[model samples]
Target: MPETPQLQVQCDAMIGSLHINADFTTTHPWTVLFGPSGSGKSSLLRFIAGLWKPQESHVILGADNITTTPVYKRKIALVAQQPALFPHMTVRENIAFGTESNQAESIAQMFDLFALNALADAKPATLSGGERQRVAIARALASTPRLLLLDEVFTGMHRTQRDTLMQQVRSHCVAHNIAVLAVTHDLPEALEADEVLRIESGHISAQGSPHAVLSEECTAWIQGVTSLREKL
Candidate 1:
């Protein structure tokens, strides 16, 4: 396997009555699946993360075919919208759980990566939403997953907090060449991605640079595109 793995997803499946069949390959360290609500975006991420094994789907990471691979064996981590943290564990302990080894260096790296040093002793109950999300991401990265799947993980965070954490996480993951697939409907989030795939009505309608796809999705709303570009 190469130091930095690339992902190739060639999948076609009927997810519970919603026929989501699409094929695309992404090598970008930070790729975003941008779409509206209930557009089967999360379903695609689930397939890649091994959360839901489609009857006919294959996820190739680097050179390995993980079609029938179990979730734990995939070297893939998923941080959901609502992070399911252990309520009893302290922040530090939570990040340290399920590590492949007692690699203190990685744990220490996470503490700095997500700025979780000060709140090491804090319990999940005491942490705010943004704090919990950051810890969740840090914990996922600590597992040394080759691929990280994020499902609307920054939904409720304030704009500044969300942007800051997203950039911090993206930078760290990109440096490690850990392929990331973030699902979001926010244009800002899509714009931040290195590559963007637009999903509509349960299929990938388009894929390309964020600006090009976003522009196609909103060709009539030219003003909207200009305003969004200004944010970049």
Candidate 2:
């Protein structure tokens, strides 16, 4: 199998109220961008996805400089918090929508991979939030993107459901050698990533193993939890 491309990003710009300055390359298959709300995690993902153009930017995937690449031609998929599936299309049809050539075998694999077999003929309006997100991810994977950007897509799902889906998605991405950069403020989600990029005030504060980068914050969170228990 061919080697997967490395994602290199160096963007410095004021996107609305936030001034984002980020320069990093992905070192793991699953990297999480962790930060508080309004910290510009989603903005960087948008920059990489070519959805938002910054004043200064240099985004390279593998050997290709895709800073100015069009959204459709970039081969990068961004699944936002909302599933945004087409109400008119069935679950299977939505999965096959963005693919240039939707092979039968590939489509079937996505259904099995995302546990969408039961919902194949169901329209988006009939699916639950979790089910819709699963279909959205399945659709993104069908497009065979070089990189996957997830902007808190699992936010509203129940913990058990979210955890199960995360495991499935991570395993699939690792097996296929597709790099994923997911944005999340949830500590548990960040802890599950192979690497974590901690953003603060629109700047990347640290990038390393999740434990090392988030240890201090995690400690404080734990202490607070313990104190609450003691008070109760």
Note the clash tally of each candidate. 0, 0
The 10 consecutive residues of candidate 2 with the worst lDDT sum are 98-107
lDDT for predicted candidate 2 compared with the true structure: 0.90
Please provide, for model 1 over 1-232, each residue's C-alpha lDDT reduced to its tens digit, 9 standing for 90 to 100: 4566778887788877788876888857788999898889988888888888878678998889998888889999999999899999999999999886777899999999888999999999999888999999999999989999999998978889988998888888878878898999877678888889888778888888888889854565677779899999
Off by over 4 Å in 2: none
lDDT of 2 at 108: 84
Candidate 2, 72: how far from true, in Å? 1.6
RMSD of each: 3.3, 1.3
Clashing pairs in 2: none
Whole-model Cα lDDT of every candidate shown, in order: 0.87, 0.90
Q: Evaluated with TM-score, which candidate comes out highest?
A: 2
